[model samples]
Target chain A: MHEGSITSQIVENVLREAEKRKAKRVLEVHLEIGKLMFLNPEQVHFWYQMLTKNTILEGSQLLIEEKPGTVKCPKCGYEGDFQYVDDPALHMPMPTLNCPKCDGTVKIVSGKDCFIKTVKMLI
Target chain B: MKINDVVKAEEGEIFDIELDENILKANAELAQQNRELLRKQGVKAIDVMGSIGAGKTSLIEKMVQKLKTHYRIAVFKGDLTTTIDAEIIGKHGVNVVAINTGKECHLDANLVQKALRRLDLEATDLLFIENVGNLICPAEFPLGSEKRIVVISVTEGPYMVVKHPFIFMDADVAVINKIDLAEAMGVDIAKLQNDVKKINPKTKTVTTNCRTGKGVDQVIAALNL
Candidate 1:
């Protein structure tokens, strides 16, 4: 799964930061995961624990903050949260890429980020 | 190693370091470099993504048949294991590089960077990267192409466009392949095309029956090749 790959990246980043500061232990990792991304937080947490085992990040807390998906429509000059189309066939609610006001092709302004905001460690 | 030290360590000297870094930045930077390299070499590249049995290989073969005499074509076939698709495309006497992802579901920018090193980009005019037959994972990883094409056949059912909106959102050209079976399968081609347009209006939609080379020229035109 892509979640496994991304979580490994998180673990790698945390380990690198820990070693750079010569930190004795890592306490927490703060992540800003966007809702637009296909990543599942539970899957990310599962992979994080598995990847961080026997490392300085073992037993650390992963604090995730999910950001909303937002878009900007160039045609209608509409900027706001994207709408979702719900169906029984969909695995989850699918966010529409069209502008809410004009149904124009909207450019993604936010909610695609998977960032490491801050690392809390014992130096 | 004691419980007391563990408890004390949790409460002592917790420093929050500010490093607001995107995890996907590395891949994005590599993709940019790839775009530059291809542009400098005068090579046009397309990243083709779709589900398994979406006629991706057949469409490439048809393209090679039509454009082989006009330009030098090279292909990078991404599959989890076998180089079967590469073998099929290689029969056309073009440069075919098979990139086996092994256990990976999709080819990342790093993998493409390595593949680029092995190819003679200067000698190539058109490069087609057939991504591992997957709709979801490949959307997240861009392989640095001039265009991103997502192929979906009518047999995949009506909800493919709605169920996987991100891929359609990211696609530059959306090809609805195997239109020959639309009547038998009871699928409405126009509705599928409309769905793609609703998701990303900028995306050019093309319908093709790659078996008999029907609508293949339209695909070539859509790619601007």
Candidate 2:
């Protein structure tokens, strides 16, 4: 899963930051995941636990915050949250890129980021 | 352990560290490196992404058959386990590198960088990176290619476009492969093209029947190669 790769990166980043601060161990990690990203928070947390074993972040708490998808229409200056088409039968939700105001193509404004917001460490 | 009389022993203190950094920064940086290296070698690399039975391998074969005489071509076939697609491309007398990603759902920049090391970039003019047979994951990972092509066959049904607009948004060219089967399958080719346009207006759409090599030339032209 891609979450494994992403978790490895997160671990690396946290360890590096902890080392820079001369910390004894990591206490917590904060992550911000955009809605547009295909990452599942549960999968991320699972992989993070598995990857942090025997490392400075072993007992650290992983906190994740999800960012909503937002888009803006250039033609009509329409800016708001993206509408997703959800059907229980299809078992898939697709985001609509068309603008509701002018029915024009809307540009993605947010919800594509996957980044670490902060970290808590024991000094 | 208690040597200091003037100072008192204290437990370690916990502090908060702020690091607002993107997790994909490393991958994106590597992708930039690959892009520069390819550009320096004057190699035009195209990333091909599609479903398993969307005829991605066949379309690459058709392209190699048509352009092999005029240009030196190479291919990087990405799969979970088997080398079947790589073998098929190699049989066409072109250089092919099979990258077995094992359990990876999509090929990332690091994998492509490793594959590039094994290829003679100086001797090759065109490089085709056939991504793992999936639409969702590949859309998130860009392989430092000059053009990204997404192939969707008529057999994938009408909802393929609307269902997966993210891939089309990242694609530079969209190839509707196996168009010859549209009439037999009772699919609307025009409606498919319209759906693609609705999702991504800039993406150039081409209809092709790779079996007969029809529309392959147009695809090449669309890539401006």
Candidate 3:
């Protein structure tokens, strides 16, 4: 799983940044995950908690910003944004990944990255 | 206080990503270590990327047969369902493990690393990653592969090259399949070759008919087999 690999990198980065700021304890950690990344957030959180057991980031709550998938319509060439969610009442599918404008195959452009945007630590 | 959905007057510039510093640093470090591991083992990986039914599997089978005679090869098959391809290659007497991605669109580096564990790296020479049959997601994830080969078929139309040039852009080699029926099917090799060249000036495109094993020698020569 990429989560294991991504988790390790997150730990490494946190430690590096912690050393830079000369902080002994980390307060909270925040991460923004894109919907179109094809990355599993639960797996990421699971691995992050497991990997950060005794590290500086241990016990820190992970703030996950859930971002939706955005697609570009090649027909109308309109890159409109939409959330890929399920409508239980409407009986719609989860991955309704189509262009709303011209009803063409949607090409994904943005929303695929794993990074640490902010960190709070006790100085 | 009550609030309603906020509306903006202007469209926002693309964020490029939902940037997460933790995940980015973690992924980068893991990838860095992965690169080192590949280097230490001298594990040269090649990814075969193409659209569905572009004869990707046929070319892979041919190459594996040729390479198996000389090199200790292994395969990391990424398919949405069924390990049939992996099973077939394993019969050829090389280590082949399939990564069945139930719904995911692509195979990332993290997934590749897990598959590599089952393969004996010391005994392996050519590690081939038969990526999920698609032009998009496969191009995004770099599974620490040394090379990427984009396989295109003439039946699909030469225009596919122009539409998805990034596949060629991320590739070190390009293979066009189903060339035996080129004339019969009214598919022009010249136009296809030109379309490929327009996207990548350096991508080596070779026409092949996997059914007859025609024009596959160039691939062998290119890989120094």
Candidate 4:
């Protein structure tokens, strides 16, 4: 359901951009989803197909790229990627945020963003 | 000239447009607005998040019981499709707003902003937003609260802390509720607290039994309310 709302925002942005450029058709939409966002790309794509109907993005292709979760430790000065546990049966994976070097608490530096990076259109 | 030899070419251009905008930017901006508005109104807001049966409602009820006399309190209850929690809190004779998110798993900032608009902020000193019961989705969404609290009970199992560290990372305070049943469940109470401290050392950890009101005072002191 979160993906549905997010897809709506993406659609709105794409349509507004297309309208500004007077594009004949939207070809592709490039998105970057952070690992920590817990968003399922397949779900977003499924919702995009349904939400874009009759809009300028009706036939546009959606391409989603996942950004890995990165964290930096303030106490140990350790910076690295966090490990995510993926169970075959679970819908979402659990991310581990412990610092790899000192096992201290780390602050997330990346993998929280859900953004539209670019849009390809035929004008 | 032959008709076949007079063919013309069709021309088309492909253009790429960059839009480096976050899908959740709108929600974040609205959340900032809510935070600023709450600050201006002299209201302290807390976002309480946890899984189902984690004593979120019970802890809130206890907090309201303890703090209601000193400060005017208001609550915004968020659920997928029920007003049951709100009804329970409403019986305490305080302001309660029930927000049904339908199929959404978590409450967003926009929803909280609407609830804030409905409540008379001037009349309230403290506001508690009880987020939908789910550990995963709620951690990612900030509802513009001054402090974020994550409640987890021993009944849910011992692995909850390690399994859901992201929620602990986002929380300012972590409440391990239902400690009275820890011995019967064959689970340790201290190890769980240690797990939380390992993930977020800065997060204030409090053990509570909301039903009996044990350690609830520590929770208040930790929140500095």
Residues B110-139 of candidate 4: C-alpha lDDT, one tens digit per residue: 999999989999999999999999998888
Q: Model 3: DockQ against the native?
A: 0.13
Task: Please give the ranking of all candidate structures by lDDT, highest first, separated by commas.
Answer: 1, 2, 4, 3
Q: Model 3, range A6-121, lDDT digits (tens) per residue?
A: 66777777778777777766666677777645467888889878988997778977777777656676678877674233436425433333456754655656565655777777
Regions of model 3 farther than 4 Å from truth? A1-123, B1-29
CA lDDT, every prediction? Answer: 0.89, 0.89, 0.73, 0.88
Which scores greater on DockQ, model 1 or model 3? 1
Candidate 2 per-residue lDDT, tens place, A71-109, comes to 999998999987565757447766767676876878888
Q: Name the better of 1 and 3 by lDDT.
A: 1
Per-residue lDDT over B1-225 for candidate 2, one digit per residue giving the tens place of the 0 to 100 score:
866567654469978878999987777789899999999999999999998889999999999999999899999999999998899999999999999999888899999999999999989999999999998998887779899999999998877888787898777799999998999888999988987877677789999999899999999999998
Q: Tally clashing residue pairs in candidate 4.
A: 0
Ranking under DockQ, best-scoring first?
1, 4, 2, 3
The CAPRI quality class of candidate 1 comes to: medium
**Model 4 regions lying over 4 Å from their true place:** A49-60, A72-105, B1-11
Give model 3's docking category: incorrect
Off by over 4 Å in 1: A86-92, B1-12
| Candidate 4 lDDT score at position A82 | 74
Worst 10 residues of 4 chain B by lDDT: B2-11
Better of 2 and 3 by lDDT: 2
Model 3 TM-score (2 dp)? 0.61
Task: List runs of model 2 lying over 4 Å from the truth.
Answer: A19-25, A49-60, A69-93, A96-110, B1-10
